[model samples]
Target: MAKSKLSEKEQVTEYIQKLDPSLAETITFLRQAILAIDGEISEHIKWNSPSFYYSGDMKPFNPKEYKRDILVMNLHRGTTILLVFPTGAKITDTSGLLEGNYPDGRKIAKIKDLDEAKSRQKDLENAIRNWMGQIEK
Candidate 1:
Protein backbone atom coordinates (compact mmCIF):
# COMPACT_ATOMS: atom_id res chain seq x y z
CA MET A 1 0.00 0.00 0.00
CA ALA A 2 1.06 3.58 -0.57
CA LYS A 3 2.46 5.39 2.46
CA SER A 4 -0.19 8.12 2.37
CA LYS A 5 -2.94 5.50 2.18
CA LEU A 6 -1.61 3.59 5.17
CA SER A 7 -3.64 3.60 8.34
CA GLU A 8 -2.25 5.31 11.41
CA LYS A 9 -1.31 1.92 12.84
CA GLU A 10 0.47 0.93 9.66
CA GLN A 11 2.45 4.12 10.04
CA VAL A 12 3.06 3.00 13.59
CA THR A 13 4.38 -0.30 12.28
CA GLU A 14 6.81 1.49 10.00
CA TYR A 15 7.97 3.68 12.86
CA ILE A 16 8.54 0.69 15.13
CA GLN A 17 10.36 -1.22 12.43
CA LYS A 18 12.96 1.55 12.27
CA LEU A 19 13.59 1.69 16.02
CA ASP A 20 16.93 0.70 17.52
CA PRO A 21 17.10 -3.11 17.44
CA SER A 22 17.33 -3.47 21.19
CA LEU A 23 14.28 -1.31 21.86
CA ALA A 24 12.18 -2.42 18.91
CA GLU A 25 11.25 -5.88 20.19
CA THR A 26 10.20 -4.71 23.63
CA ILE A 27 8.29 -1.75 22.24
CA THR A 28 6.54 -4.01 19.74
CA PHE A 29 5.44 -6.31 22.54
CA LEU A 30 4.14 -3.31 24.43
CA ARG A 31 2.29 -1.97 21.38
CA GLN A 32 0.48 -5.29 20.97
CA ALA A 33 -0.28 -5.63 24.65
CA ILE A 34 -1.65 -2.11 24.92
CA LEU A 35 -3.83 -2.37 21.83
CA ALA A 36 -5.33 -5.58 23.23
CA ILE A 37 -6.82 -3.78 26.21
CA ASP A 38 -9.58 -1.93 24.37
CA GLY A 39 -10.62 -1.54 20.76
CA GLU A 40 -10.92 2.22 21.22
CA ILE A 41 -7.24 2.62 21.94
CA SER A 42 -5.18 3.52 18.88
CA GLU A 43 -1.56 4.44 18.26
CA HIS A 44 0.48 6.77 16.09
CA ILE A 45 3.79 8.54 16.09
CA LYS A 46 3.78 11.57 18.38
CA TRP A 47 6.75 13.39 19.86
CA ASN A 48 8.86 11.12 17.66
CA SER A 49 7.74 7.97 19.49
CA PRO A 50 4.86 5.55 19.65
CA SER A 51 1.89 7.31 21.24
CA PHE A 52 -1.36 5.72 22.36
CA TYR A 53 -4.65 7.54 22.77
CA TYR A 54 -8.34 6.91 23.30
CA SER A 55 -10.36 7.30 20.12
CA GLY A 56 -13.72 6.98 21.84
CA ASP A 57 -15.94 9.97 22.43
CA MET A 58 -15.43 12.00 25.54
CA LYS A 59 -16.59 15.32 26.91
CA PRO A 60 -14.86 18.01 24.92
CA PHE A 61 -11.89 19.76 26.42
CA ASN A 62 -9.02 21.95 25.43
CA PRO A 63 -6.50 20.30 23.14
CA LYS A 64 -3.63 21.49 25.28
CA GLU A 65 -5.14 19.56 28.19
CA TYR A 66 -4.17 16.32 26.42
CA LYS A 67 -7.19 14.47 27.75
CA ARG A 68 -7.34 12.06 24.83
CA ASP A 69 -3.70 11.11 24.89
CA ILE A 70 -3.19 7.99 26.99
CA LEU A 71 0.56 7.77 26.87
CA VAL A 72 3.69 8.59 24.90
CA MET A 73 6.96 6.72 24.85
CA ASN A 74 9.98 8.75 25.96
CA LEU A 75 12.85 6.99 24.18
CA HIS A 76 15.31 9.85 24.25
CA ARG A 77 17.12 8.32 27.21
CA GLY A 78 18.00 5.28 25.06
CA THR A 79 18.60 2.58 27.71
CA THR A 80 15.17 2.59 29.33
CA ILE A 81 11.68 3.05 27.92
CA LEU A 82 9.46 5.57 29.65
CA LEU A 83 5.72 5.58 29.09
CA VAL A 84 4.67 9.10 29.95
CA PHE A 85 1.06 9.65 30.88
CA PRO A 86 0.10 13.27 30.30
CA THR A 87 -2.81 13.46 32.73
CA GLY A 88 -1.84 10.51 34.88
CA ALA A 89 -2.28 12.28 38.16
CA LYS A 90 -5.98 11.60 37.78
CA ILE A 91 -5.54 7.84 38.01
CA THR A 92 -4.93 6.28 41.37
CA ASP A 93 -2.50 3.54 40.40
CA THR A 94 -1.53 1.13 43.18
CA SER A 95 0.17 -1.46 40.95
CA GLY A 96 3.50 0.26 41.49
CA LEU A 97 4.28 0.04 37.79
CA LEU A 98 3.72 3.79 37.51
CA GLU A 99 5.84 6.21 39.46
CA GLY A 100 7.14 9.75 39.47
CA ASN A 101 5.62 13.01 40.64
CA TYR A 102 5.50 15.88 38.24
CA PRO A 103 3.69 19.11 38.84
CA ASP A 104 2.42 19.03 35.27
CA GLY A 105 0.10 16.11 36.03
CA ARG A 106 2.28 13.42 34.43
CA LYS A 107 3.21 9.93 35.55
CA ILE A 108 5.75 7.58 34.04
CA ALA A 109 6.10 3.83 33.71
CA LYS A 110 9.61 2.55 33.29
CA ILE A 111 10.60 -0.60 31.41
CA LYS A 112 14.25 -1.41 31.03
CA ASP A 113 14.03 -4.43 28.70
CA LEU A 114 11.75 -7.01 27.18
CA ASP A 115 11.85 -9.30 30.22
CA GLU A 116 10.81 -6.50 32.54
CA ALA A 117 8.14 -5.30 30.10
CA LYS A 118 6.61 -8.79 29.94
CA SER A 119 6.63 -9.16 33.69
CA ARG A 120 5.05 -5.76 34.15
CA GLN A 121 2.56 -6.04 31.29
CA LYS A 122 -0.41 -6.72 33.55
CA ASP A 123 0.34 -3.79 35.76
CA LEU A 124 0.76 -1.60 32.72
CA GLU A 125 -2.63 -2.63 31.34
CA ASN A 126 -4.22 -2.15 34.71
CA ALA A 127 -2.81 1.33 34.83
CA ILE A 128 -4.12 1.98 31.34
CA ARG A 129 -7.55 0.65 32.30
CA ASN A 130 -7.46 2.75 35.36
CA TRP A 131 -6.88 5.77 33.17
CA MET A 132 -9.60 4.78 30.74
CA GLY A 133 -12.17 4.31 33.43
CA GLN A 134 -11.63 7.83 34.62
CA ILE A 135 -12.36 9.29 31.21
CA GLU A 136 -15.10 11.91 31.05
CA LYS A 137 -17.62 10.69 28.51
Candidate 2:
Protein backbone atom coordinates (compact mmCIF):
# COMPACT_ATOMS: atom_id res chain seq x y z
CA MET A 1 0.00 0.00 0.00
CA ALA A 2 1.16 3.50 -0.71
CA LYS A 3 1.91 5.57 2.36
CA SER A 4 -0.18 8.58 3.04
CA LYS A 5 1.56 11.89 3.56
CA LEU A 6 0.93 14.10 6.53
CA SER A 7 0.21 17.79 6.05
CA GLU A 8 2.64 20.33 7.44
CA LYS A 9 0.38 20.92 10.41
CA GLU A 10 0.11 17.21 11.04
CA GLN A 11 3.84 16.77 10.69
CA VAL A 12 4.44 19.50 13.24
CA THR A 13 1.79 18.07 15.52
CA GLU A 14 3.36 14.65 15.32
CA TYR A 15 6.80 16.07 15.98
CA ILE A 16 5.61 17.85 19.11
CA GLN A 17 3.71 14.82 20.38
CA LYS A 18 6.97 12.93 20.75
CA LEU A 19 8.31 15.50 23.17
CA ASP A 20 7.39 15.99 26.83
CA PRO A 21 3.58 15.93 26.94
CA SER A 22 3.36 19.16 28.93
CA LEU A 23 5.67 20.93 26.58
CA ALA A 24 3.80 19.51 23.61
CA GLU A 25 0.52 20.68 25.05
CA THR A 26 1.91 24.12 25.71
CA ILE A 27 3.24 24.43 22.19
CA THR A 28 -0.08 23.26 20.78
CA PHE A 29 -1.95 25.93 22.69
CA LEU A 30 0.39 28.60 21.43
CA ARG A 31 0.14 27.29 17.88
CA GLN A 32 -3.63 27.58 17.82
CA ALA A 33 -3.56 31.03 19.34
CA ILE A 34 -0.98 32.20 16.85
CA LEU A 35 -2.98 30.90 13.91
CA ALA A 36 -6.03 32.74 15.16
CA ILE A 37 -4.29 36.05 14.54
CA ASP A 38 -5.63 36.37 11.00
CA GLY A 39 -6.19 34.48 7.78
CA GLU A 40 -2.79 35.49 6.45
CA ILE A 41 -0.92 33.95 9.36
CA SER A 42 0.45 30.51 8.50
CA GLU A 43 2.76 27.92 10.02
CA HIS A 44 5.41 25.43 8.87
CA ILE A 45 8.30 23.38 10.09
CA LYS A 46 11.41 25.57 10.37
CA TRP A 47 14.55 25.21 12.42
CA ASN A 48 13.27 21.67 12.97
CA SER A 49 10.25 23.11 14.79
CA PRO A 50 7.00 24.95 14.17
CA SER A 51 7.48 28.43 12.71
CA PHE A 52 4.73 30.99 12.11
CA TYR A 53 4.61 33.55 9.32
CA TYR A 54 2.36 36.40 8.27
CA SER A 55 1.85 37.44 4.69
CA GLY A 56 -0.97 38.45 2.41
CA ASP A 57 -1.21 34.88 1.14
CA MET A 58 -1.49 31.89 3.41
CA LYS A 59 1.69 30.16 2.36
CA PRO A 60 4.31 28.33 4.36
CA PHE A 61 7.97 29.20 4.11
CA ASN A 62 10.62 26.93 2.63
CA PRO A 63 11.90 24.59 5.33
CA LYS A 64 15.44 24.78 3.91
CA GLU A 65 15.93 28.19 5.48
CA TYR A 66 13.90 30.69 7.48
CA LYS A 67 14.23 33.20 4.70
CA ARG A 68 12.33 36.40 5.50
CA ASP A 69 11.92 34.89 8.95
CA ILE A 70 9.28 35.94 11.42
CA LEU A 71 9.06 33.64 14.38
CA VAL A 72 11.45 30.67 14.89
CA MET A 73 11.27 29.82 18.56
CA ASN A 74 10.20 26.61 20.28
CA LEU A 75 11.13 24.02 22.85
CA HIS A 76 14.86 23.47 22.94
CA ARG A 77 15.35 19.78 23.81
CA GLY A 78 12.16 19.85 25.94
CA THR A 79 13.78 22.20 28.38
CA THR A 80 11.96 25.49 27.65
CA ILE A 81 9.79 26.77 24.82
CA LEU A 82 10.59 30.18 23.31
CA LEU A 83 8.80 32.29 20.71
CA VAL A 84 11.46 34.10 18.71
CA PHE A 85 10.96 37.34 16.84
CA PRO A 86 13.86 37.35 14.41
CA THR A 87 13.02 40.85 13.20
CA GLY A 88 11.46 42.31 16.30
CA ALA A 89 14.23 43.93 18.24
CA LYS A 90 12.30 47.16 18.41
CA ILE A 91 9.04 45.46 19.31
CA THR A 92 7.94 46.58 22.74
CA ASP A 93 6.93 44.24 25.55
CA THR A 94 4.35 45.97 27.71
CA SER A 95 3.23 42.63 29.06
CA GLY A 96 6.70 41.86 30.33
CA LEU A 97 6.60 38.45 28.62
CA LEU A 98 9.59 38.75 26.31
CA GLU A 99 13.21 38.13 27.24
CA GLY A 100 16.64 37.49 25.81
CA ASN A 101 18.83 40.15 24.23
CA TYR A 102 20.44 39.17 20.97
CA PRO A 103 22.42 41.69 18.94
CA ASP A 104 20.74 40.77 15.65
CA GLY A 105 17.31 42.34 16.33
CA ARG A 106 15.91 39.13 17.80
CA LYS A 107 13.75 38.67 20.88
CA ILE A 108 12.18 35.66 22.54
CA ALA A 109 9.36 34.84 24.90
CA LYS A 110 9.80 31.81 27.10
CA ILE A 111 6.67 29.75 27.64
CA LYS A 112 6.93 27.13 30.35
CA ASP A 113 3.53 25.42 30.31
CA LEU A 114 -0.07 25.63 29.16
CA ASP A 115 -0.94 28.05 31.95
CA GLU A 116 1.90 30.36 31.08
CA ALA A 117 1.10 30.08 27.42
CA LYS A 118 -2.48 30.98 28.22
CA SER A 119 -1.48 33.95 30.34
CA ARG A 120 0.73 35.30 27.60
CA GLN A 121 -1.61 34.61 24.70
CA LYS A 122 -2.50 38.25 24.22
CA ASP A 123 1.10 39.34 24.43
CA LEU A 124 2.14 36.70 21.96
CA GLU A 125 -0.54 37.80 19.55
CA ASN A 126 0.51 41.41 19.92
CA ALA A 127 4.14 40.55 19.35
CA ILE A 128 3.37 38.55 16.23
CA ARG A 129 1.15 41.24 14.79
CA ASN A 130 3.67 43.91 15.62
CA TRP A 131 6.47 41.84 14.18
CA MET A 132 4.55 41.34 10.97
CA GLY A 133 3.97 45.07 10.74
CA GLN A 134 7.67 45.70 11.22
CA ILE A 135 8.58 43.30 8.44
CA GLU A 136 6.21 45.11 6.12
CA LYS A 137 7.97 48.42 6.67
Per-residue lDDT of 1-137 in model 1, one digit per residue for the tens? 66467788888898888888879999999999999999999999899889999999999899999999999999899779999999998888888888888999999999999999999999999999999999999
Query: Using Cα atoms with residue i matched to residue i, what is each candidate's TM-score against the true structure?
Result: 0.94, 0.81
Candidate 2 per-residue lDDT, tens place, 1-137, comes to 99899887788888878977777788888888988887777777887889887646434555443335668756674667878877667777778777777876677888777888888899888877776665432
What lDDT score is found at residue 105 in candidate 1? 95
RMSD of 2: 3.6
* Model 2 stretches with alpha carbons more than 4 Å out: 57-67
Q: For model 1, give the 10-residue run with minimal summed lDDT.
A: 1-10
Mind sharing the TM-score for model 2? 0.81
Q: Against the unseen true structure, what C-alpha lDDT does each candidate score?
A: 0.93, 0.75
